[model samples]
Target: MIEWLATFLTSSPKPDLLRLVAVPVFAWAAYRDVRTRRVPNRTWLPLALLGIALLAWDIYRASTGAMIGGLAERERFYLRVALSLGMVGSLGYLFYWFGGFGGADAKALIVLAVLFPTFPAYMFPNTALPLTRTTVGVFSLTILSNTVLVGAVYPLFVTLRNALSGHRAPIMFIGKPIRAADAVREYGSLLQTPEGFSRGGLDLDALRMYLRWRGVTLAAVREDPERYRDPTSLPDDPAPPGDGSIPDGGDVVGPETTDATASGGDEAARAADSTVADPADHATDAEAAGADADGYDDPWGAEAFLDDIEGSAYGTTAEGLREGLNVLAAEDVVWISPGMPFIVPMFVALVVSLVYGDLFFELVTLLV
Candidate 1:
């Protein structure tokens, strides 16, 4: 064991150290993304800077003839770095612009390009690192490919789970039926509405964001459903003692306010209503007054509350929220797609790339 450890440590100490440092950081980012569907932009800054510094150091070593390779090897190293950064960076941005990658995911790939422009070679007792390598040897590109391959397994798992549960509908593979009461507390998007299932679902994360922006808890809204349903209620701001007037800047519902929140709400409501017929009447007034809706009440003031908050943030639009609210208001059980955070797969790919190299490349090589 000691001999093996010594060999591993000696075989690319700098690259090994960087890989070790990255494991914990990527783990943290993945955990946060799973829990909150967000990772702060600042999360990547330190890693990005460190990657830049390391790349610069490598270049300096090559230029000073301290690196093992002579002039030809030095020029090759420079070319590799240029190709990796140029190709990987451009691809990352294009993915983001085309909506295939999240901002953080794209940044992760770019930073990876800076960090590991070429495969970091290592020798172990049983096998060699990077079992296969392409001519360009863009490590970031390899990571991206590996990530996609690793992520493909999740859909199969979802499909199998749904099938075992007797939900054979094609849509069931992507999402599951969850109680409407649990919707606010969950992650993912609503896949069902009052009318039926549709692919263009409402994002629950946006609903959570709107709730936070209003400074009101979903629990509180559930407790006093009618209070929130009223257009005049300003829960985020309290009135002065013995005064009924709403405080300034409070989200008061009125014609003047229609320009911002209400207008968005109207548009959202129309969009939501477009696909579904008028909601069915199945609940008593008493049950309708509650948050659970029981398929009778319109989502207790969901549109009005959405209209009271700031214009959309966190990928939420008023129409989406309105559609989601309509479903939540009108359905007891709604199907939701619990999105898999791409960072989780990216982290797994990073580990696999470090130890086994690109699995996709290896498979292709084996076939050929």
Candidate 2:
């Protein structure tokens, strides 16, 4: 046992050590993604830098013939690393560009490529360390394949949960219904709207984030819905604080706005009149607001807040907020699809990759 432990600790090429270090980091990232649906860009920086440093050290050792197989092995190591980075790095960027991967997910994969361009080896008495590996042996690719395999089970779980709850629609396989009032506090997008069942409606989770970013709470918004809806009523506040900069006061209402509009002032009366407009005018207004003919308002200043942010970090747009708000305001119940946070499965894949190796490869080998 001591001998094995010493060998494990002193393993050459050292990627296994990095992998062990990454476990906790990946776990933290998954937690953040699950809770807030956002991971800070800085989260990947340390891992990326450490990966580069280790790669440099390995290359240096290989060049000096200190690597296990001398100069002959150096060329093979170079090829493997190049191929891994070229293939896996390109895939990660492409995934993000095509919207298949989030920015953080893509970054994680790219960093993994740099960290473990080739599989890191471990030894066990009864079993080989990696039960399966691909022909190319790109470790990041293995991780990605494992992630997909793990993520694939989520839909089945959703379906089973819905089935047990007596909701048997095809759409129920992807989402479930929750009270509209609770939508703000929940994690998902509205799957069913006033019109009908739709896959894309309002994202309640994003709404919650937007409100939190603005230093407010769902209860506060519910208390004075009309005040938040009126754009002109709000004070000229600066951009919403960045992530983790939530204002000192928790669950506090945002800056006070004029109550004139809520109290049936002239602007309020005009808004009321606009609601009764002819179909053509109503359609024009709805189009402008990016909502349907049914009344939609930015009750939490979501549109302005989204615009102020550099990018769609929360995976929502101003128009999307308006459309979602419209549904939340009008509906008693809304069907929502709580998106599966990919990071969670990615973390699981990391662990499985370290322990049991490539699950996809094993399955394919079994079938073949």
Candidate 3:
């Protein structure tokens, strides 16, 4: 069985063999991403190692002039492959650093850079694409361009769907509205603001600013010093939520209280628990107590954001969305992100690039 499997993978025309190998790998990645919204390193690391070995072998062949025909062409091909690998690796790392590329995506691009550096001659025997020629052997860029182009079509499809459905919100082009209750049940992310809550989405910039205002940085929080406590541990606030940011305090009526006296008693009870549950909430309550004593409106007295739920990448909790749902009790719907997996488009792009040699490049050439 091992011998037969090796024969099947290696016996075909080089292009066909490459496709056979790639399809299974790409399909698996796409499937895993769709199911888990994450790609484990175990899925791509072996492929990357395989790509490195193949590229090294290709280089050896080129250096020794062991080509069956057109030695010069082979050398150029290997050189282009090497250069493309370097360029893609550098850019992928940079993009990952800046959050433009997800972890799986950056690693996948690097693997592709090593594995499919050139347009497979067998797949497009008589191709005359100028972009192909310019890229030398680097087909991954073309694949990326083609992938983006193909992915763009889905947004248009969603827009048309929304238009036909009579959903007129402009933000519907990027995302659609659903019930906040359903969003919580389905683990969907907020796409828009609800009443009494700050904007629904996690604003990384705002979070950074909030941390800075509290005299803490992400580097410090991530390092997790014994004395650091939390990112929002300023002298004023003293302690914040687990994510190091303050929940938007508004008129939140807790179920345990009916009148101001009951709410105050509940707050006292909460102060006792907050030291253990969340010091930040306790601090906010202390501040609210002072404000109430001074006859000022207390934002922290509401306790609407108090329910704890699992945390998300945006640092908000399910409890936060639940609070938003409470505030939006008058509204029927909310906008949310369904967590689109990008690997699906990447898989499509891989197949498209293999068969068509870059859709974007072909369009550009036709226009020229």
Candidate 4:
């Protein structure tokens, strides 16, 4: 069966093995990288090195076996090989620059490129050729086939694994991110989460951002407590009150007139707010106390912070942060975007494919 299959493929009997090896090898590496955010040197280095070695061997043989039959002859065949690899290389380069792929992925691409120049396209009945006068057909099909296969599987895998682990990222959006309680009883449909509320989890970016903001917030409130606090004053601790600074309730309050014990700014106003003689005069103190009940302005600017900065590459604005969060929340995607709208290797392929597909093609895309 293997011999028969070999005969059924390229008359050259080579790009087939190269393609066969390249596909699953690269596919597994690529998928693993997406899942673990790592592209091991072992897989990537071997693919790139072996590919180059094969291409080199093909080149040496082609030069001596110059009698191989073809219309354009040896020079053109070699040139065609270069073109095929070139197309793949160029796409990989762009993705790397745009952060869609890593250094290892870029190298893997280079390995794939050499096959065409080193071997021959007729190696697989693969009608792909590039930059040369040869039709732009094969590039398109490969890209389309690849996109459908890779794009669907990787993200689906990421989502399922993350969700199943009950990993809900920390949420600090609320006045105080409620530890997403296990039983959110609207009427009493005890739907509980396996994992209890977390500040947020599994997202390095948000955690980084949270830490930065928390430090800034603490410093700001510490430095400008009066400006941040609503009452403009805090209840004076009789003797070096607990912590020197009164607990400024969450919200901002106006200057208080009474609560002699209200906010500080007095010589004889050290009496308890309730003990004050003129309760009516204590209106400012009452208002300040009320405001404390509400949450205060985020001195740290946490309200506007967002972890997904890449999505902004196309255009993510401040106001759009809400839209971004809403999308994350709806999809239950935690901190990651549902559409990792990367610089898909297929962008170039799209144009190249359109050229050939219009000239000649038919495809059946099966989402499953």
Top-scoring candidate (lDDT): 2
Deviation from native of the Cα of residue 56 in model 3, angstroms: 1.6
Clashing pairs in 1: none
| lDDT, candidate 4, 135-212, per-residue tens | 333342354444445455555565566556665444212112112111010111111122433322222223222223
The residue-by-residue lDDT of candidate 3 on 230-347, one tens digit each, is: 2122234323333322224321222221343223243443332222233344445534334345432323222222322123324444344334423333345766555455677878
- Global Cα lDDT for candidate 2: 0.68
Provide TM-scores for the models.
0.74, 0.75, 0.62, 0.41
Worst lDDT window (10 residues) for model 2?
Answer: 273-282
Worst 10 residues of 3 by lDDT: 300-309
Quantify all predictions' global Cα lDDT against the true fold. 0.66, 0.68, 0.53, 0.38
Best by TM-score: 2
Report how far off residue 158 is in candidate 2 (Å): 1.1
The TM-score of predicted model 4 comes to 0.41
Instruction: In angstroms, give how far residue 233 of model 4 lies from its true place.
Output: 22
Ranking by TM-score: 2, 1, 3, 4
Cα lDDT of model 2 by residue, 234-336, tens digit: 3345425444222233222223323332242444433432321222332345556444455545544666677666666456667667667667766667788
Give the Cα-based TM-score of candidate 2 against the true structure.
0.75
**Model 3 residue pairs with clashes:** 118-137
